[model samples]
Target: MSEWDSGKNDGKPGWNDQPAAVADASEGKQSRQDRKLIDKLVMSMQVEQRRSRRWGIFFKFLTFAYLFGIVLLFKFPLGQGLESATGGMHTAVIGVDGPIAADELASADNIVSSLRAAFKEPDAAAVILRINSPGGSPVQSGYVYDEIKRLRAEHPDKKVYAVISDIGASGAYYIASAADEIYANRASLVGSIGVVAGGFGFTEVMGKLGVERRLYTAGESKGFLDPFSAEKPEEVAFWQSVLENTHGQFIAAVQEGRGDRLADDPRVFSGLIWSGEQALELGLIDGLGSASYVARQIVGHESLVDYSRTRSPLRNLVDQLGVSVGHGVAQYVSEQRLELR
Candidate 1:
């Protein structure tokens, strides 16, 4: 760009005197045009420089956000919200833990993390899953259950029990079923042995609103779950088959976990929820006991320790901020930069 600039004079002296009037007049007009052109070019270059700076800042900000906000900041929460500092002793009580997402709950977020911290202690006699979840993902619940099974297998002497305070239906119960024994209050709603995927029927809504759904995909089932389109019969069948397969897996796991403890009946897998007392009759749950009773009986220590991450308002805000940013990136990537609504 600099080489293109003709030094603002194009090899001419500061001022010319020995020239004809016509030559001088033509020269002046040409010089004026040249100056205007130079001014416009300089202005364009400055605009481009600013644009480049903004792009640089954008990339830099995103880089910092991924490093500091997502990765490093994510771990800081775990350290900041330690169970020891929260005054939990003897028995560990793990709460809802996280959003119940698969990867987060199992590997990075909550469930396994709580169990790990609890079991790592030398004095931890018995670990309790103080579950209060309406349930979320089957994948996550299965992972949590398997992890507990693994942990229990590794430490065969230790007892892992689940005490549901409120709701422990579906996936929550799936994990709880793997416990050595399950306890819940009489009023707690337990069991919803099923899988469900939800979405809106925007086919009619979009039709009425003159909205066009432009979903591009490479696989047959790629856009099958698209909310904007009417579900095809084959797609519905495919999903139903998938749901049936996953539901079978859940049932098998429960059967293997609870053995003859769980009553053999259709209602168990009928997607029906029952009170804890009712579950006991059905053999879905073993007994009615709170965290206190479990600790006193199983752990032999009356004290408690909340191995689960109980975050403060400030800590929660940071966690949520990181979560929202990560979710945005994940959503963007999953949708391939497309959004339905």
Candidate 2:
């Protein structure tokens, strides 16, 4: 055999045998590299899976917390927890707080309901309307006034008294006039017997801004007292006449309620506010006292039970949201609003 074909030459491997060993070593190294790559891939996948699980758990916990908060809001309300503990003879107190609008806390519906409840209760000695407002809608005040009169006629034994706290004026006083006797603190503001309507004229502003008002109305007076349009003398006069007529009605109602108790001063019905002491002098208020004082002294009952009808928690929440959105919309669309205040 030749030296090249022999397995050994000079006790060392031949070139052909060296090539075979090198191929085997290269194959083994490639196998080890492939195994390391697979292990790294497996470890990377495990780490990603662990991170995803943690994030999923965190999101699930947050969702649970959000649901729990919603439940609590629905369960508890803001300010409505009045219990009628009329074990014996007690005085019924109905709160006429805030504006006296149809949708307000002192609405005619709420006040009438409270009045009826107080009058119907056998343990209630008398009904006291605890008022603290700057006044609002005349229609709402009129409704409450008429109801108080009717209830007073029905329940002749149980008297109805009005006790003004901080301030009671205009429509507030209108309702108070129907009471059997009215009372207020010495510094309380009382009486504003008049009607008013006001709005800003934006015609000049529109002219400066090069804005055109496109108003469509079928009737002649459909767009009466529009803020965007120019004011007409006849329309202004007509609006004034309407206000005077409403004022006349307000005066008549006050006269009928107060009778001879009112003073001869013309300023009493001139939309002027007066202190409780001045109101007493002008016959606007019968006495000077608080709800507690009237309850203990006039009604002869020390125990006072709230008979005010409060809005439900769900209704309050809905109203709050609605008012927030509606208020902005109202300001943008119509800045002019007719109110007693």
Candidate 3:
């Protein structure tokens, strides 16, 4: 009561007597600043997210373009499928490159189709089989040889020539023998007229490792040449007889194809290879020339057109993507096969 009466410094405001309006105004300013900072942070995050999304879309498009380019390249290679468009007289070239097998690029089905196409084309002056291989399956080679002969018989006016490059031996030569005349470079290797069947015997290794082999078969000779089992002398002799029969068939085909042009040399069919020069002397080849030289000098046609069968674009894509790995592995592990190598 005494302090009130004194009025505490005559109307001056004390520390605990501050006005409420001033405090409310200060708090309102701070709240507005905090709201502005939060809004700015949210906007910045959205901008960063948009930038990342744009980059992702751009990279996706780039990847798609790359794959599309690859597909186009596989679909249309240089100098392929131009025979129909060219529509003029040219030397038809059928390529028999790599291993001659049922599943290979130089397969019987592919080579046969190519021959038919070349023969059917009216603009084709002559057919040339361009061979470059180490030789593989005898069956495939036989099929190609028979097809070539039938095609030649059908179109007697047109001739089929075989031009070997690098090394064309065994199954490759088998196919070449069917041609009207065969040619090769002077240094090229020619003629490995033989049949071969080979495998590894793992029985001793398994026995040493204490590994038991349990193979089930329906027939007695079904597992005759199995690698895990002991090889019997009788089985080996039978296998040899089969090979000899195949070799005889091969020799007969060569003799029939070459006729009197082939020389009576024992070493020609002794499963030995010879240089192209030596081959010409032995009558294995008609002349020393390349595909172009044969086409220009022999066929009298300079322009060349490829009629070889190739894989489809879709199949090529699948192979490039490694989709056929399992199938290839299964084939590799299936069985032993006979080859003309």
lDDT of each residue in 215-300, candidate 3, tens digit only:
99999999998889999999999999999999999999999999888889999998999999999999999999999999899999
lDDT of 1 by residue, 87-154 (tens): 44477677754335543432325778878877887667788888787776777777788888999998
Lowest lDDT block of 10, candidate 1: 332-341
Those runs of model 2 whose alpha carbons end farther than 4 Å from true positions after fitting are: 1-81, 315-335
Tell me the whole-model lDDT of each prediction, alpha carbons only. 0.76, 0.87, 0.89
Clashes of 2: 0
Q: Which stretches of candidate 1 lie over 4 Å from their true place?
A: 1-76, 80-89, 102-109, 212-214, 318-341
- After the best TM-score superposition of candidate 3, give how far the Cα of residue 134 lies from its true spot, in angstroms: 1.6
Query: TM-scores for all candidates?
Result: 0.67, 0.77, 0.78
For residues 105-148, could you state the per-residue lDDT of candidate 2 as single tens digits? 78998888888888998999999999998888889999999999
Q: In candidate 3, what residue range of length 10 has the lowest lDDT sum? A: 76-85
The number of the candidate with the highest lDDT is 3
